[model samples]
Target chain A: MKFKIAILGTGNVAWHLAPALEEAGHTITEVYGRSEKNIKGITQKLYTAESKTDLDFTESIAEIFIIAVSDDAISEISDEIILPEDSILLHTSGSVSIEALGYSSATYTGIFYPLQSFSKDREISFGEVPFLLESEDQTTLQKLKKLAKSLSHLQYVVKSKDRKALHVAAVFASNFSNHMIRLSEEIMARQGLDFEMLKPLIIETLSKSLELGAKKAQTGPAKREDLNTLEAHHQFLNYNEQIAEIYRLISQDIIDSI
Target chain B: MKFKIAILGTGNVAWHLAPALEEAGHTITEVYGRSEKNIKGITQKLYTAESKTDLDFTESIAEIFIIAVSDDAISEISDEIILPEDSILLHTSGSVSIEALGYSSATYTGIFYPLQSFSKDREISFGEVPFLLESEDQTTLQKLKKLAKSLSHLQYVVKSKDRKALHVAAVFASNFSNHMIRLSEEIMARQGLDFEMLKPLIIETLSKSLELGAKKAQTGPAKREDLNTLEAHHQFLNYNEQIAEIYRLISQDIIDSI
Candidate 1:
């Protein structure tokens, strides 16, 4: 069955999600963003949707209204949008509580958090990503579950607290990991090396972690407690005090934990 | 087309390299390690090889002798092992210079550095890794090139200084990235969340980096300069001073860099 969906944001999440939802055989009835220009881009990309900058969502028009806005904007948009008693509402926030939608007029409200970092240019395959879904009511839960199953192979029903936990973990896994790579590029640049050289090692490290859990797969000077190499690397980064401090702090943490 | 090979050192590097060499149709004529127990494992794993725990290596037995040992031990092991005239000898240390093996008895010496972290339990496929090779002599370089080509698809004939750059980069790419995952696990633990929840995001982050280099793919609170959320996270980690400090430092660094 084709479900009618309306998106309520034009950020990275909506930019990626709108197209994916349409590709999965759903009709994007209406698209809303804070700016007219933003809505124009989304509407242009997703040709089948009516675009609006203002929050004037009507009830019973679309089966689902997905608010893919920032963590702070979710509540405001949900509050402003007047939904039908039979419609279901969902937010794509990993941290925000599902109950934020409970006060709205919609019959059902929940979360539809995608557990991955999104960029405008990078096209991610939703089929491989795990979607976290939650609802206070059974009907809302089933509807979100069906929607998630249509896009991704992996789906988990988690509570708001658990979803928050996953969100924090995602920051570490996605955001922090990328920072480390950027740091590596900086460290290599000091030594006159290209960042491309480290690509193979980066790929292997992640693949190894996937094969063995992070706890068991951990290696390097910190894991092995090779104080000599640690000191040498620390000395190498002495010129850059900030990186040196990070080296010391993270190495100490790993050592203390081990 | 089969190259005769002798493996020096029976630690993690030797344990991994020896099997890979044999699988590549190379003849392992001799295996050397400091302890009988160390050589015992390789001998049992690979049949038809003479095992020696002492420094003594037969004269002109193989075309090449690979010294796969600790960075500190590379020079010492190379100095101790007496090889045949015009024989090629290589050490698998990322940081150590190729010139360190110059003082060795072998006339032709080079580096056969594998840019991947090796663990006993984890079996890594050499075909996927990039082997960074360096040699002063053209003949020795040709032999190393052939050997590396047989083992892996990617091979880079890098200089000693360039290899050092790549080594530091590998630390950032592999070691630092693992630390990021560990930090995420730590953060999740405090929040009463399982680290497993972050696995998909971790995989996605790395895959994205591979597709769209680290600089372009960077994202998070730091990248966005969302000080409100940053302050909230810092307040959230008030109980754990060490992690809180790290979170603050890294977030600040990302913000500064951006």
Candidate 2:
């Protein structure tokens, strides 16, 4: 099931995916990127992959070409890359659709979106990371399933619309949650309090919520419907109108949910 | 350093704190609650404590009494409880002030607020849980510090105003973060997707944010300024205006923070 693979774009997705693919027994035949620095960055991780700074992949032995670039660049790069005939072409994006590839040079075009946030500095295991897989045809989908299973046990065949919903869900689950901590950090800074003091509470609350399910794990003045504490908090935060608005809306949401 | 203690409430805080204090070498002399079931529930966890369903503590020999009730009940219960003279009285509330005790029967009044979300079903170690300690007098503050140090390493002598700020910050960090996950769960349900699929992403994102600090760990369409993805997500969420409003406010906050 191991196929020769060529990864395009050396961004966060490509930086992580290329090494993970190689580690999963896939042979990385080539690493291509417009930036020489990024190409060198990814090529250093592979044992036998050659680096290419151009879109030329006509002579590539890669059976699967993965374009792990930005959404805007995906279509442009898909139209430009000259993959071998009958090869499977994939792009790793949560928002972009399979149709965006649109009858490319490759016989099959698909999406290989990893439903997790990736930072180049943090090392992550793909074992539990969900990979949303889709293809233009059934045969290409089976190939993707094989590849995805090798890296992670969690793989789903989602359509473009569902994939888009998942993307928005990720925004809430990952990005919005992180920003909540940022807002807390700002509040702490205003009090001359160290952000470290809130770390244990943050970690425990999130862990407990995940364990007991978020709906069951909701706590605080909002969930308790304590008007005195809620009023006191609002009065304290009245100096910052934006933060106060957020507090009011989100607290109302929690109360309404309850 | 060990002292005799009486807990006046059989709530989540009392359930966790009584056992933690007992394990730290303190003697739980008495447990009090209006509900016999709750009194029995907490008394079972202690070796030497007697359960009381009445407010009769005039003859009690305990050196320290803790009011681990709701914020509204704190003042009423503190006033009604006829504790022995010269005993230290404490209330475990993040928002309530020490002055609320207002020269009660006990010679010393203080706040022993453990800044964490506690549940009766969960077993939480107090070692890392920060205890925000405050008292009416310098002498009582020192005693509160000693008691806090015995239970946890992270004990802070925060004034009432700073503690109020911390409480609001906690609402954002713990409660708001959990709600974000709840919102994500709702979004997943709308798409007929399993909420479990987003668990890995949720855990990893929060962990990364904690490790690198939230500002550096932020990643999403908003952070990237991908208007295509942002607009697509907005259109997808147009079915619900409240969620869409939340989406807009949080995303704008992230963009502004960047």
Candidate 3:
């Protein structure tokens, strides 16, 4: 069940996935990164994994080459990756199609797209993270599925185009929600109010929304049509048009949703 | 030192506070509501607490009258409530001031605002919910403080204006975040995606945001300035102006904050 892996790109996904692959009994043979200093810790803990600055593999040594780079760099790096006749190549970009890797000389190509946002410093349990897979044929997909199953149970056969839509959903669920917290933090600071106290509230609100269903869990002045409190907040944020506009638009949306 | 109390309103806050007050050894002497059918559970659980539809107190009665009605109704209820010469009066409202109860015939008026959202069906531990207190005088504040201390250790002495700001902050933290999840749910529904899969990401994102500080914890294309992916999502949400507008404005705010 163990396959040799060469991870390209030392970003958050690479940092998390490399160790996960190693822990799942996969051999991390090589790691390609822009800086050797950055991959030192990764290489040291990993068994027999070496760090390199460039993708100068004349012949694919590892069974699988995972291009865990940025969206823009996926094509360039995939093009540089040289794979053997039967070896498979993959990239972790959600938006980029499998064809991005297909343009390369690799005989078999696929995607091992983990549907989770990774923080380089934060430790994420890979087993819980959903991995999306896409390949040209059933045989190639089966091979990739075995490798994916070893690392994560949550695996799906999602191609690049579908992943794009999922990626859009994720932007709202994960990214924009974080932005809301950021907005909350900024808005609280203006009134000299403490953001720390809202921690329990923020955590419970999201958990409850998910448990009870978001539409049913929605509560606020906007939801209640309480004009007084809404007007008060509007006047409070009047000085900052950006914030004020956001408040107006969001409140109106919440009202309209009902 | 337990005061005989009368609670006006059968809403979420009142439903929780009445039992909490009784459990804390305070005498729940009376419960006032718009209808008798709704408050049967509350009266049955409380000792010697009579349920009435009107707020008529001819002579000296329950030492404290708690107006736990809506913000707009607080002033009206307070105006209707008549108590003895030195009887204390309080309203459980985050936005409404202690002055809202000052129009009442009761000598001492205060606030006992629990800084937590409540659902009537949900069982919330009052001990963990922070309570905000305010009063016209030191003695009245101290009296209300003792009552607040009996239910929760997390008590803050906040005045009207400050509580308004805190209320506004609560809306952003609790209400708007739920709206974000709703937006996430709606956006996902368009492409036949399961929102249950998003539970982990939503839970972790907020917990991580609170733990690491919202600003530092922020991730995604909005934060990374990944124009292509951001543009893709913008186009994906093109038909729906509300969702698209929210996406654009928040992304711009995130970029501006950086």
Best-matching candidate per DockQ:
2
Highest TM-score model number? 2
Model 2 CAPRI quality: high
Give a tens-digit lDDT track for model 1, residues B43-96: 777867788877666554687999988878888988888777778889988888
Each model's TM-score?
A: 0.90, 0.98, 0.96
Off by over 4 Å in 1: A1-3, A22-26, A35-37, A44-48, A99-108, B1-3, B23-25, B44-47, B58-60, B99-103, B136-139, B189-196
RMSD versus native structure for model 1: 2.8
lDDT at position B28, candidate 1: 90
The sequence of per-residue lDDT tens digits that candidate 3 reaches over residues A17-119 is 8988988998998988888888785787688888888777655468788898888899998887666667788888777888887678788889988877678
Q: Per-prediction interface RMSD?
A: 1.9, 0.9, 1.3
* Cα lDDT tens digits for candidate 1, A1-258: 668999999998999999899999999999988778988878898867987776666633788999999888888888888876588889998778987886777778889999887878777889877888898889888888889999998888889876765565666678777888888877777777666667867776777766665666677788778888788888877888998898898889878878
Query: Which model, 2 or 3, shows the larger TM-score?
Result: 2
Q: What ordering of candidates by DockQ runs from best to worst?
A: 2, 3, 1
lDDT of 2 by residue, B39-103 (tens): 99988888999988877788899978999999888888888778778888999999888877885
